[model samples]
Target: MATYSEEDYLMLSGIQHFAFCRRQWALAHIENQWNDNYLTIAGQNLHHKTDDPYISETRGEKFIVRAMPVHSREYGLTGVCDVVEFKKDNNGTQVFGKSGKYVPIPIEYKHGKEKTNHSDELQLLGEAVCLEEMLFCHIDYGYLYYGKTRHRKKIEFTLALRQELNQTVLEMHSYWQRKYTPRVKPSQKCKSCSLRDICLPELLNRESVNEYIERRLSE
Candidate 1:
């Protein structure tokens, strides 16, 4: 399908989790399972601080919008952007109530520092692509703000990255359609995963931690 209806659109944020671990994504998104570890709680707090739909400000040439809703029908994805800074530019497009044309730059906030994996980049690119579809503009890059290190890192949306994103989203859609959840392949990353206990990689079955506990108690 060239495009998906709004109803078919999947959660755009799930790409990050899917990239980190497909099982993690399936558990949280498909199985409706989740747990709040320190990292997740911290990330939620950071998102809360940054995501306020009512908050919009004009800073000279920059118009800042918090919790901007964005989507891409082509990718069948939807999510809220933490911050979308519209900077005044002659080559940019016009805003609804604003006077001048502006280019949108998306900034994502994470509780932890930069990771060795490309999960963060994949998620950021998903947002950028969604914005491109919504704004009808080309965004060469965006920003990733690390909550732990308190630093902002620039992320370029390269041709290779876009290709990778396309593949990732397609895989996600296929899995979603089948309601498929893959078995866990244990790794060091599991140690810090928020859903580690729920996943119970050691068992590598459909059973959940609570279910296992209850069954053991009866036995």
Candidate 2:
């Protein structure tokens, strides 16, 4: 049997939650459990919409959408992008007729409306980080194409977001190094989590406290 390294432990999307909530990241990635609800299913289906290969012409620019596999060894993350658009840059003229270059814009499709936080932004930013490292270029912005609003919202990859992304990568590495699974910290988000059944946070908490009391009595 082949042994999986700690580098193989990180999930690309997990970095998002690790930034939002460390416990949530550990629950999903470390525990190996997930429970899919209607929202998650709908979001997944939205991604499927862009999974196929297709090209579109818009205002003299060609947009090629592809489901590309992306990975970053530096961040220890790997995942697939829903749609990556390549636009030709005709500004610099030197090598090949105004030098057409590839500018990668990763579009993430979500099922629900935008949230009042940076969770979604962080996720997209993580993808941008991976793309930047892979492409060796500055990706200034990307779009979050939402199904609910039926529009594409431009996201500026700010310095703060980049900092958060770096912090998330470091924390995920630390969490993945731990041998024991973390205790569940349940919240309303858990209701939407697919791992609720397997996690059994409420039950686990009760059992843990009971065992602690029993051990004290025995002592």
Candidate 3:
């Protein structure tokens, strides 16, 4: 597998889009065109809330919250994580544990309630993959904290998910090599995309239909 530098490739979060729809991913990331909607603005503000540094200790558990810059050389991905939780593992034997064990957990914050989509899950998994490579540990699971529900959902980094994530890494690199701007193909997900206006999938669909008819007539 060919690996590229972090600066040479776009962030791994883009892989989530490639999994959702390749064209959508290219249109937003490659073209660098984005439409700011209320939802995106709200999401930005929500992320801003957690961007700062803070430490909270409660009930013998310590929580350190801060943004993290992550990258994967093998995956050629780079992005920042919203928050990570570090806690000391009390379950350690005296002889075996010279120092107290510390566990690192990644927590991603979303602006909306849980939806019937894998985009968020893939993004989190990508982050986990990067963390695993950097920390050289097996990250078995993480949590997604939904703003709407105001609750955390535990996600297991199963073998299946890891396989899919690896595939995404490969696909994203291939797409970046093409370096062609993607046209919009509207779908249910478009309603929430911040690049809806720039993508204009509906308009592109119409154009495609018209071109098909014209080509048929000429034939």
Per-model TM values vs. the true structure = 0.93, 0.78, 0.80
lDDT of 1 by residue, 107-133 (tens): 999999999988999999999999888
Q: For candidate 2, which ten residues in a row score worst on lDDT? A: 90-99
* Better candidate number, 1 or 2, judged by TM-score: 1
Which candidate should be chosen as best, given TM-score against the real structure?
1
Q: Evaluate candidate 3 by giving its C-alpha RMSD to the native, one decimal.
A: 6.2
Worst 10 residues of 3 by lDDT: 90-99
> In candidate 3, how many Å is residue 190 off?
2.4
Instruction: Give lDDT tens digits, candidate 2, residues 51-107.
Output: 765644343443555677777666666777777776666431122232366667778
Q: Could you give candidate 3's per-residue lDDT for residues 138-172 as a string of tens digits?
A: 67788888888898999998899888887877777
Q: What is the lDDT of residue 161 in candidate 3?
A: 85
Which candidate order results from sorting by TM-score in descending order? 1, 3, 2
Candidate 1 Cα misplacement greater than 4 A, ranges: 205-219
RMSD of each: 2.2, 6.2, 6.2
Error of 1 at 146 (Å): 0.3
Question: How does candidate 3 fare on TM-score?
Answer: 0.80
Q: The CA-based lDDT of model 3 is what?
A: 0.71
Clashing pairs in 2: 34-194, 35-194, 35-195
Which model, 2 or 3, shows the larger TM-score? 3
